[model samples]
Target: MPEVFTAYVRIVDGFNRRVGRIVMYGIFVLMGILLYSSMSKTMFLPAHWTLEMAQFVMAGYYLLGGAYSLQLDSHVRMDLLYGRWSPKTKAVVDVVTILMLFVYLFFLLYGGVSSTAYALQYSETSYSSWSPYMAPVKIVMVIGIALMFLQATSILIKDIAVAIGRPLP
Candidate 1:
């Protein structure tokens, strides 16, 4: 069972990492497009709108990259106390952190859904020419939070395996 679970985590983490990389590339392309639009007089929209699009893309990029960041162990952490812990102690701390993250993400998902619903109910739109519905962005927040939560679960499972004297399959 541990082997199967570990294999599943590896596969999912790989897939998410690839998806995150694609998202990052898309962000770069979007930035280039925005920059081109800004520099070209032929473009109808104002420069501010292009800036807004860049901001939107950046937000998406961060959200989508979160799971991959966790998989890579690249997320920022304060090591002031954690660095002193033994391997087993570190595993325990990791489990605790994962639980906290799970709870936080649960709330974030709930809040995101609520916000999106409200936006949809009120027919929210951008204050500029684009007039994009805000609900879509809010929905993406839910997806991002959910993905982060899943990544936390994967880490927690690995930590548990280590704590139990397993080789992580």
Candidate 2:
């Protein structure tokens, strides 16, 4: 059973790592394309399109990078106090923080789903001339929030196991 659980964890971790890298790289590529388009637009099309593309790229970058940031533990934190704690204490703090994040992200996911549904129903699009499909971008928020939530849950589970002395497989 422990071996099976270990395998599961490894599989999940590997999958998240791969997905994170893909999303991060995808954002970079998208940004590059947007940059080139904007540069070309300065001479060809309207300048407004460049702003729209920039906005889309920025939103996409943040959403897609969220899970990767969490996975890498690169997100900002107030370590001034947390850094002083012992391993066990740190584990406890981590568990608590994960719980809080889980709750917050769950709410975000709920809201995102609702918003996506509304957008879908209304056939939402940007009010600007560039008017790309807003539904897709909105949907990405749900995916990003859900992924972050899952990562938080996974960390919380591992931290709880450690706190109880069994530890994670």
Using TM-score, give the best candidate's number.
2
Number of colliding residue pairs in model 2: 0
Q: Residue by residue across 1-169, what tens digits does model 2's lDDT show?
A: 2665556556656666777887776766666767778677777754556667667766767776777687788999888888888767888889887877877887888899999999999999889987777898888788778777766666666676677677765
TM-score of each: 0.83, 0.85
Model 2 is weakest, by summed lDDT over 10 consecutive residues, at: 1-10
Question: For each candidate, what is the lDDT?
Answer: 0.78, 0.75
Ten-residue segment with the worst summed lDDT in candidate 1? 40-49
For residues 1-169, could you state the per-residue lDDT of candidate 1 as single tens digits?
3577888678777778786778768667776967776676465634555666666777777887788888888889999998898888899888888888888888888888898899989988889877777877777777777778777778888888777777475
lDDT score of residue 2 within candidate 2: 61
Per-residue lDDT, model 1, residue 10, is: 82
- Most accurate candidate by lDDT: 1
Clash count, one per candidate: 0, 0
